[model samples]
Target: MSVAFIDSHMVEKFVENSQAFDKCIEERFNMLDMNQDGVLSRDELQNDANDSSFVELALQSKEEVDSLYDVLFEKFDTEKKGGLNRNEFGLLMKEVMLAKAHGFGETPVCVIFQEDSLLRRVV
Candidate 1:
């Protein structure tokens, strides 16, 4: 049987326990920052065997992961910046986590490119 990708109740509980989620995100961020770079690049942040830890915790796809880099380059590149800086990086990470969390499910969440909206059945 295919495992359900996300648990809505768990997410609700996660939101209810905001502090816990914050801490979890903080720790997850640290773990994602391999090589001690303090910032995550597309290559560094992309899902891989080495970084499969997030696979079990979050439901994601290769396309979504790749698209994230594209979105980051498109939106957060204020000042025509070539890449994300520390602040931009942090915001990007937060948004990604939120989007992912919002989209968690058995099937990959369809991300609406127009407003970057997430479409899913929460209830």
Candidate 2:
């Protein structure tokens, strides 16, 4: 893991760069896919969530985190197919990155991004 200071401007620039953003998201999706299948199942998503310690989720209890992941998985599974395709995963990343950008505002915050994490790629 490595630490870096990230602000909204940095995140916005990364998001605006469509090619880089898409590439990073695609790589992350593939990493989380686990089974080499084109689609990501709920179990795969849950496992990824459980494996990663997200900054925002640090304060939440296990039950709360599980519930949150369920909601997030449902949001990403837009087709109601019980799995997330590459396109759906891309959309999910877009929203998540945008949300982080907005949440950061003008302040730079210290963050420890895990190796292979999307935030690390953004930086």
Q: List ranges where model 1 is wrong by over 4 Å.
A: 1-6, 47-67, 76-123
Lowest-lDDT window of 10 residues in candidate 2? Answer: 49-58
Model 2 lDDT per residue over 10-123, tens place: 998998999999888888888889898989887887677665656556678888887976787777888888889999988888898889889988899998888767777667
Clashes of 2: 0
TM accuracy, model 2: 0.85
Q: Candidate 1: how many backbone clashes?
A: 0
Instruction: Give each model's whole-structure lDDT.
Output: 0.50, 0.83
Tens-digit per-residue lDDT, 3-122, candidate 1: 223453444555456566555545655665676665555555563223433443246576775676677678875645454455565566456555656666544433323121121222
Residue 35 miss distance in model 2 (angstroms): 1.8
Question: TM-score of every model?
Answer: 0.45, 0.85
